[model samples]
Target: MGVGGAGCSAAFAIASSQGFQVTGCDIEKTSPYLDKRLKKFVSIGHDPAHLKNSEVIAYSPAVTSFDSDNEELVMARKRGLEVLPWDLFVAKELLKNKFVIAVAGTHGKSTVTAMVGVLLEKAGIDPTCLVGAIVVDWGCNYRVGESKYFVIEADEYSEKFLNFTPNIAAITNIEFDHPEYFRDFDHLKETFKKFADKLQEDSVLIVGSDVNLKNNNGKTNKVSGPADLNLKMVGGFNQKNAAIAAAVAQELGIEKDSIKKTLESFKGVARRFEFIGEEKGVLVFDDYAHHPTAISETLRAVREKFPDKKILVVFQPHLFTRTKVLFDDFVRSFTEAPVDKIILVDIFAAREKDEAAVSSLDLTRAIVGGKAKYIPSLEGAATYLVKEVSVGDVVITMGAGDIYRLPTRLLEKLEGKG
Candidate 1:
């Protein structure tokens, strides 16, 4: 099967537990960011020969990225071997056997999933967990435990999360971000409502206080009000996410003190307001905030974290479809953001082609009341930032793409190496 981010994560979850003879392959032989744990089981390139001894085949949902007709998958099909997507396989083999806690939303699903996992683990409940992003505490995207509890990040892309059967489901928040898969905002909302309906009759569903979901069958708890836990993370959004995590922990009967202690000390997942090394008094951060809402919230959080400090943003739009569809909203998002200047880089087209005729310069020109500049490459942005950034300035590299590497170059520039 395709062993990209999600697939490699599932493989690690199984391999770390020592419960299965796991094997996997990607279209490429190596990745700079490949997990060290996966080096033994996963090979760089694909060959049907790798599937020789496989009994059951599990594939990543992003199978199309490698090859729709992946040779190993086709060989499995020809041999009549058991085949399933990783999500569906997890649903059938894992979620059905455990008390599943599924975190679903347009944003913050990854963080909330990690939050709940860390809380449960800190409370001495050795729960199994799978998250979309790497939890710095685990140094991986998954944790394997013998406990009956299973926590998973429920993705809404192509309705992928509908496959899982969750006893307790949580929605961090809902918004229109995935325009490539959804027809409209209403379609996204309806899909979420359908996901909420998938819980069993007695299952519990928790929604963020700001979101309004219609769940008829399950017990729904809306998280609101101040929590006793003090989050070390910077965003107001993190506080809200903590509230949601607290609600889930309370539902599981975990002591309030344990939840508070865990949330307060949580170091956060990678690429979510992660602080890179500061150089010459200029602070740099890396974040996975591609959506307009995420960008605005992150900028506002940064402003609050370093009051009166000039914030500089370097944003790389993730996909052409998103940039094209939300062009206006993207412009408006940066208008009121707590930043002094914005650097717009070329779009990072992940699994999509540029058919919408939209470009980064178009977005840069549309932004009003902000000092926005267009820099097509991360190197260009880093070079510009080196000369412009001064003391007491916070520079952020925000996106879901290779732009994260910009900070290293920014640091080099600050050190006078670049």
Candidate 2:
């Protein structure tokens, strides 16, 4: 019922495109996918009345986790409706009888999923696709193609990806994340291994060179190095993502020319190193790099692109559990890159309460050098940046939270609008 989120919204859109009469509700009234894709009215908040006519209710993970006593969910249970999480609903209903190409990993799955979708479309495969982020070319998170092929960004959180048995799969890379759910790194790896083992006989499983899923059922292919082709997207990680997509396309018998053409022209998904705009010679970009590894890789890429430019990073740590669990890595990630300044805003705390021991100030204090500063609010960060930022500076808004809103404020202030 929470269709405003990226995952649930894409699922709802796919269901609607498949000619199902779907109704949705969310705490928020608006989203980009709601506007561009499912342009219909949805209930603003959860209510038992909202579930009146629905035979089956599909809910987002956030809906149940954040508010277990939500009225709609309670009512659905009382009525004995067949309620399912969005992932399970998509897997059991929509993806049935399809050639599923599921992409799973800690990072890069969204880009790889979008790339595979675009490559398949270029090769006239007409594959139905769903990714976690909005692909710039598609202008949405899903494509409703006519073929039996289904390409999806299979998420690992809560072991949700285990719902689907893919004919083809890809593991971009694996790292410990979602500390609140997983016990440790070994648990996370075991979950991935289980996912890999779900593949059908003679199916293909493409992995990065560093991934080691020992006993997967499918034929394994290891892809390494930056793709040799010219790419429009920056970063070594993206080149690796393209290489994985190429491997998948090759497995499906797509022509080399078509794969190359798609990867070269692919614009990229929203918020993964998305360029906002430039003002007064200060280039602004927004990225969804909240994890320590992603933060390091992204900043390294930016430094490589603009070697002489001073990078001002505005980082909002995503969840308190994550910040606490990976605090040391977070500290080291900043130092690994040549970033000039790091502004740390308060942790986003997506679905968790504040931990007394961990905060953004703690992270700032943990940084080795004096490059980091703790700003408690987005408004304060924007104000400080507008005053401190100058020519030849590359400003990056890095986070998975509402920190994306800061870039617009900074751009407006730069234009003297505020």
Candidate 3:
């Protein structure tokens, strides 16, 4: 099977561990996420020409479903081989379980999905799990187990979550995104409403408590949680995510106390505002907030949590299309909680060509009333942080890229570890 993104990582782990004779492929293989599993891949370029022996083709959400000629897809179909999409595979697995907790929403899918899995395992649930991001406890994305419960990230990228009939569904805030796939916020909201329609009669749907369901100047109604879900997290948004997850866990017969304890102990997921070690006197952190909405939540959280400290951000623009599409939104997302310093790194263009004339300059130019500057590479960005950063300044390197390593490397450099 062929796949990409966090979904692909799961397929790789499963196929590799089960001795299913899987040969994965990708274009650039240097990033921490890509390079960590570099030993198990073989590919000259982005196309699936190397995996010619693949019996059936597997695709990720990043892979366009409408495109029939997506190298691996076209080749497999031409040879009369089956093409099973990742979402379909994940959905089928969830259907077999009596207690499937599906985490669905535009944002916080990875964090909430992994949090549920962690809580279940901690509570001795031994539930089979499928998360988009790699959890520290599992050290892998997908797990095959002997349990009745299953939890997976129910993504709305292509309304893929609709295929899964979850026993306990959780929606951790719905926002407008993936403009390349959807037309407008209305179209996206309608898709989410349709997903809600798929739920069984009062089977329990856990939505964010303070989530503005309808976007920009629209109907921003909030979905209240159960009495047991009355707990707080880092930010208002994260607290909502924790509440939604707790509600789902409670619906599955998990005790209210355990839910509270588990959520309180949930530190957070990697790249979702992860805390990297500090260097000298500056505190280092990282987050996987490529979209403007995510950026808003993350920056807001840091601002609220560390109000006295100076907030410094090392931002990397992911995907040329995304950066180009919401260029101004990226700037305005940080409006509410404006930081003291900003270091803009080169755009982490994944899959898409630089046709939209997108660059780091767009984000830098849009950052209003902030000390925003452009740096080309991770090394340069880290160097600038070292030279310019002062005591009590919180440094956050954010994006869906290998920017997290910068903080670690900087710390290592300071401690003579590198």
Best by lDDT, which number?
2
List TM-scores for all candidates, in order. 0.94, 0.98, 0.84
Q: What Cα-based lDDT does every candidate model obtain?
A: 0.85, 0.89, 0.70
Which residue pairs clash in candidate 3? 271-288
Worst 10 residues of 2 by lDDT: 32-41
lDDT of 3 by residue, 1-418 (tens): 3344677656555555435666655444442333255445645344647546677555664555334456766666778876777677556533454566788787888878987887787788877777777665566566655577778788887678888776667788777787767898899888887776676654566667644433222222245853334333466677666766766666567897887787776666666677777767778887888888888877888888898899889888887777877888887875454688888889876555667587897778777775788888989887777777777888888888667678887776666532
Candidate 2, overall lDDT?
0.89
Regions more than 4 Å wrong, model 3? 1-4, 14-21, 28-53, 61-72, 92-99, 200-202, 210-233, 412-418
Tens digits of lDDT, candidate 2, 120-219? 9988999999888999998989899999999999999999999989999999999999998999999999999999989987788999878987435658
Most TM-score-accurate candidate: 2
Best-first order by TM-score: 2, 1, 3
Worst 10 residues of 3 by lDDT: 212-221
> Once superposed on the true structure, which residue ranges of model 1 sit more than 4 Å away at CA?
6-8, 15-18, 28-34, 226-228
Model 1 clashes, total count: 2
Give per-model CA RMSD: 2.1, 1.3, 4.8
